[model samples]
Target: MHQNPGGLSAAEIHTERKEQQRRRRNSLLLVVPILLFLFFAFVAPISSMLHRSIYNPTLVELIPDTINALSSWDRTGTPKPETLRTFSIELQQLAKQRESGRLASAVNRSYPGATSLINATARKLRNVDPNQLAQTGHLALLDTDPRWSETKLWQAIDRLGAKYRIDNYLTALDLERDAQGNIQKRQSSNIYIDLYSKTLSMSLIITLLCIALGYPVAYCLAHAPARIAGVLLVMVLLPFWTSFLVRTTAWIALLQTNGVINSVLQSVGIIHQPLELLYTPLATILAMTHILLPFMILPLYSVMKGIDPSHVKAALSLGSPPFSAFVRVYLPQTVPGLSAGSLLVFITAVGYYIIPALVGGTEGQMISNIIAYHMQQSNNWGLASALGSLLLAVIVILYWLYDRLVGASNLKLS
Candidate 1:
């Protein structure tokens, strides 16, 4: 046989190394598109939304001097002469840039006296020496209106300077700021805390109802023979095959005073007249429970199926009562499924804007409907986004708490 080369050819070795490096680089390159896509799609939009929530432009850009001058003064009382000096400087700069309108609009957003202030300052500047204008004209201008020296105006300017503040968060909760920068409950007309409370309460109620209704059904399905369980599962899933809107509408027709339920009741002499069933909390709860029952059932069924039947028998043989056995053995085992189902149903219920809007009366409306109204009807993206972010934060905190509790329980069990 021909003798092989003792050492590899230099070209062959170089080619092999290069091939290996190319493969490694290609593997790294594969992640680039995915990262780029995520940034462009999800991160970019969310960042844009966060930016929009705190965005108030003209105060920071146009009136920096005012913000700085007010920084030294206490917000609880009337502002000093320095605050007036700052305003004069801001107005002069605005006049030079011909952007007085923008400055007016900014001030107008919070407190009154924007257009008159801007106009008066522009006119006053014409009579004073340009260099001495801020120092001299500022004091004289304040004498014209004592409201100019009031702390409320300075406080309003200060609010814009902080950029990121709890103001929007407080506002969403129907709280307002006083002249002293303290938050208090809003007037009855403006108060929306009730809506938030109602939304949370309704979600909890619906979740409880789902658990109560779905537990037995799920237990039966879990214990049945495989063939029987499959048939029952198909029946449970049949509602999902139909459009949600169609199902809701069908319920509306069925539950209406002149419709199937009331007609059947009246015919059977169950009541003197058709009960007011269509536009009440009862209707909303019943409809939501019907729709969400499957969410609870599926999770519990999955967990119950995974559980060995011998555990319950062992508990009974140990002299535990039937209910006690269930509480000690079966119930503890179903914690994971219960948690999963409750979280799913609760989160889903909290965001139920369309269902509540369509079926619920004034007293039954949730926070989501108000947020939607702000977004679509009023075009108040700031308020809408603030509310949405608050809701998201609340959900995240709840989930984190749930995870911690579950982890602790698992650790203890192990």
Candidate 2:
């Protein structure tokens, strides 16, 4: 029998290879469900958000012929008469379908009085015969609204007619391009940048507060007797058993002007009047810190549980000062958990919505509140997606900076 030196037979080796391939296929099959879940849950929504931020099809779909006609004419003046006639016919069709609302909204985002311009022209066009729309519809539209005579109105149509745009991102950043296409600060709606700063600042404060408050509790839980540690750990995790909304509303009761805290303070003679604490930034910070403190403590306690108490004792045995022993020998061991908990708390605090929305009055509203405003109230999903994409980018960049400078995965053991 002929065989390779390392194999019993070529057929045997081939059978083994088939067995390995089958195992590999089975392994992949086992994970396919999770992979599909991740793709649909995370990747799909993110892709949709990214696409919405740039590609809006409302204007392009509503008046494709009008946009195609405007393509030939320079944007320096009113579009050609044919383009106006085509736009009038499309508006008439949309009016018939009751779909003018979306177009009016899209147009108004770009140009003022766009609803009036589009709706009024639609009203005027219902009287025009569709067959004659190609002949005299442009004149009818001009008679309906003299604003159509203006260059800016046509410019907005031509701009929004394209399927892809960066205007949403520009507006999200409180910026705009001038007529000459130079990027400049927007005179109107110049609040997004400030909101981003406030969000980041508030998130940082919440992280720090979580650390200051959670670290001691975590250390105590880690070092206490097993019986006491189990009870303390329950206290830490007790918040999870309650509904999140219930927990947040409990703060509403505590911080409200005539609520438990104010009544207690008044009874104790600490103050005569109730404080305006419920709907302010301080309330946002405190509530968020409370909600996120357990995130810090749990990670810290987990890490601290595995840490050796003898490390600090050994440092003191070597004649090191107590503070020096704690800092130099013991503190390094907790860096992994500290970084993880900080990152968890900070990211959660940054994207927080319900807490801020419930308690954050006008003065305390964060960037997420503005994003919700754009999506829910204003129906400006493009701007909301752009803001969300920007927020995601900021968190990613900050994480990258942290990994580079602090190295979150850097585990030090001595």
Instruction: Return the top candidate by TM-score.
Output: 2
Model 2 spans > 4 angstroms off: 408-414
Residues 289-366 of candidate 1: C-alpha lDDT, one tens digit per residue: 888889999999999999999999998999999999999889888888888999999999988887777677666678
Off by over 4 Å in 1: 1-42, 58-165
TM-score of each: 0.72, 0.95
Over the stretch 1-414, how does candidate 2's per-residue lDDT look in tens digits? Answer: 679999579889889999999999999999999999999999999999999999888888988888899989787877888888888898899988888878888999878789887877777687678878888888888888789889888888888888999999999889986665578999886699989999999999999999999999999999999999999999999999989999999999999999999999999999999999988999999999999999999999999999999988889999999999888877788888898999999999999998998997887789999999998899899999999999999999999998886683473342
Candidates in order have lDDT scores of 0.79, 0.89
Global fold similarity of model 1 (TM-score): 0.72
Error of 1 at 62 (Å): 8.5
Q: Cα miss at 382, model 1 (Å)? A: 1.3
Evaluate model 1: give its lDDT: 0.79
Clashing pairs in 1: none
The CA root-mean-square deviation of candidate 2, after full C-alpha superposition on the true structure, stands at: 1.8
